[model samples]
Target chain A: MEYPSRLIENAVGEISKLPGIGKKTALRLVLHLLKEPEGTTAELTEALTELRTKIKYCKDCHNISDDEVCNICASHRRDRSIICVVEDTRDVLAIENTAQYTGLYHILGGVISPIEGIGPSELNIDQLLQRIENNKNEVKEVIFALSPTMEGDTTAFYLTKKLRQFGVKISTIARGIPIGGELEYTDEITLGRSILSRTAYQQD
Target chain B: MEYPSRLIENAVGEISKLPGIGKKTALRLVLHLLKEPEGTTAELTEALTELRTKIKYCKDCHNISDDEVCNICASHRRDRSIICVVEDTRDVLAIENTAQYTGLYHILGGVISPIEGIGPSELNIDQLLQRIENNKNEVKEVIFALSPTMEGDTTAFYLTKKLRQFGVKISTIARGIPIGGELEYTDEITLGRSILSRTAYQQD
Candidate 1:
């Protein structure tokens, strides 16, 4: 489509690059910004620029942070001995939102996906191993909380193989039907796994 | 949700202010941008800032433009006598994509909507009228291509009252069931209107 202005075209082009945002939605967002006060756009520009320029990852966990170490890693209340390994910062946020997991995180940045040419060496696997080796006694357990996907499982398997000699207790998150999920609606493989991995119940 | 870093929080807050973007979606987008090359965010920032700071409106039609007069209004190939009036620049672009009309555009900026506290004076209605009055007999037709909503109809009615003295032909785009639209799913009002406004078939 022919844009009346090059400025608008450029803004739309940049905005539409975002995931799940189409050309139409991008145009709507850009126009919404145009309609608001000039300060709004300025603030957005500042926020994005500062986020990219000033943003850093926690040295220990590879999570996005504003400082040398993230707040989660630095917090005294968190369980440093138990680290939940995951894909990216979003997973960290997701797990944090649950409020059930108090353990520190190990963001791999991404999974080991051969299709995408991503491997163990490209991720923060070495740092994680170093973290465990450095605090062998302090870090007692390493938990694999990655997604239930081929890539996630592959990454977890690779990590497990590397971590076998560390002598720490290695575990993975459960692969059962989700809470409030109906047995009938569950996918065949998940339902099958949920049944096969069922724990023995002891009556109260 | 608890953000690990203040910078990520700030960026998410600013991004979520955009229309149709919720906090969760905002976080996802921010994380996506963070995962991409740093230059991507920098480019978006630069584009948004430049667009807001440097974008101009056409003198003849209040459409967003790089210069004083937009390409559509200034182009010699366009039918200067016919002016298609729309609610916003998006509408102009939508119509332009159809490649059916070659007329100059008169962007109203928005329709008359009292619920949102928007009125005729807030729009470029006066400028449109002034353009017609100034052009006089040179401009022969005024087309109302705004959305077929109550506000659009009200705005068109008001413009027709003001444009009556100019002795120019006025028209509106046809409103009916959309092409390939299922009759059973069409809303009663639109279906009725489609039947009422049925045109004679000029078959080959």
Candidate 2:
């Protein structure tokens, strides 16, 4: 169990700090790296160092970008008038991967969580409102694509109330049982769908 | 599919660089970090930044140390005469965890692998030799605690030959079929043991 020296221990210490990596796993990785060609550790080290230095957030949609603006926001092919508001940048990427939605996105950064002391002021809601007001001549629809959690719901309701004043159409992603779901195991998605689709909730 | 912003992607990229971490696992880790208080990312960033800065190799045995020498090398309680040579710092920790041995250590940095262009010259063999010569009056046993691999065996043999001139006792860890008896499923350990334990090489 004795290591060859301090160099390996330093490497293991750095590696163990990574997510899901315990000391044992870190030791395994360090051993594997030690067994590789001399330049392997240098490559991994360089990649890690550059990861933080070279990458940045897109100023517009907030997606990861090597440049000031992310590819999705800069692409003219996407619909500039419709904005899909999501909880995190990951959601933006997920929607983009489907190749079905061609609209620009607005990353809310996170949903409202009262328990965590996160309020409307802490979010990017002000910028969202300004974006809608500024783009009124061209913009049409705003989609709330946040998650189904309580915080997500709170943010959706808050956004709905605020954006109604902007005179723009707002719609939340439909909630209901997911596709290929069994009725017995159907989650609150089904229950929520039934509520949203109720006759009284519909416009007269 | 979309991330909330470039921050998540940047974090994910950083996480994925660690050994054994894939894109999905990286995402999970990033999400875990994101869910924490705002200071969590700062802590992770701080840990990574200080990883290389704070830790140093032990001057004598080459184990990791916060000071000039590692605890094991500086301690008066350890058997300084008995030096156990291992492949890396992780082995040092592993052996220490067992608490069976109280001797000093010599880290080889790595085993000799000709296929990988690593020769004895690339290892810390010279340091070990120098240590033995310098402390001729104090040194006694030098155990070769190498892995049971081809490269490990070759290095052990090579070290044994080189150290034979110095009149030091050199021995490798025991190798044999394991405790469990399943001839069909027996692994290399058992197989190697059965071969090594053979009466003698018989003439054909």
Candidate 3:
């Protein structure tokens, strides 16, 4: 489409480079920025620039952070003996929102996907092993909280083999139907797994 | 959700201020930007800043432009005798994409919406009147291409009253069931209007 102004066309082109956003949505957003106060655009650009240039990854867990170490790793209340391994920072946020896990996190940055040329070395696997080796007694359990995808499984298997010599107890998060999901509508694999891993009923 | 870094939180907060974007989506976009080369963030921010700071509106049509007059207004191929009045620049783009209309356009900036505190005086109504008055002999028709909404109708009614003395022909884009829309699923008001304004069937 022909844009009336080169500036608008340039803005839309840059904004649409983001995933899930198209030319139309980008145009809408650009126009919205134009309609808003000039300060809005300045604030947005400044924040994004700061985030991209200054943001740091936790030295311990590889999670996005503002300092050498993340809050979860620094917090005294968190269980240092246990660490939940996941793909990216977003997963860390998702699990954190549950409030069910108080253990530390190990963000792998991404899983081992041969199709995408991401190997174990590309992730934070070495740091994880080194972290466990240095604090062998302090770190007792390592939980795999990655997605139930082929890449996730491959990464977990590879890590399990490498970490076996460390003598740390390794486990994975359960695979089953979601809490509010209906059994009839659930996929066969999830439904079957839920049944196979059924737990004893307990009285509230 | 708890963000690990203040910089990330600030970026997400600012990005989510846009329409249709939420905290999660904003975080996803922010993280994507972080993963990309630093220059990507710099380019995007620069484009948005330049767009907001330097973009101008066409003097003749009030459409977004880089100069005093837009390309459409400057084009000699366009029919100067006809002007299509729209709410904003997006509508002009939409109409232009169809490649059917060759007339010029006059953007009103926005339609009359009393609930939102928008009035005729707040829009480009005066400029539109002056434009028509200055080119009284050259301009023969003024077409209303605003959306079919209460505010759109109100704006049209007001403009019709004001432009009655200009002796120029006034028309509006046709309103009917959309092409490929099923009659059974068509809304009542649109169906009623389509039937009321039924025309003789024409063969392709």
TM-score, first chain, each model: 0.96, 0.82, 0.96
Off-target runs (Cα >4 Å) in candidate 2 are: A1-75, A172-204, B1-18, B22-59, B66-69, B174-188, B191-204
lDDT of 1 by residue, A1-204 (tens): 878888988999999999999989999998899899999999988998888889999999999988899899999999888989998888888888888999999999899999999988999999999999998889989999999999999999999999998888999988998899998999999989988999889999
**lDDT per model, in order?**
0.91, 0.74, 0.95
Q: After superposition, how far is residue A82 of candidate 3 from its true place, in Å?
A: 0.7
DockQ metric for all predictions:
0.87, 0.16, 0.92
lDDT of 1 by residue, B6-69 (tens): 8889999999999999999999899888889998998999999999999898999999999998
Better candidate by TM-score, 2 or 3: 3
lDDT of 3 at A186: 98
RMSD (CA, Å), each prediction: 1.6, 7.2, 1.9
Residues A89-111 of candidate 3 have per-residue lDDT tens digits of 99998999999999999999999
Q: Write the per-residue lDDT of candidate 2 for residues A94-144, one digit (tens) a residue.
A: 887888899888988889999989999888889888888888887899999
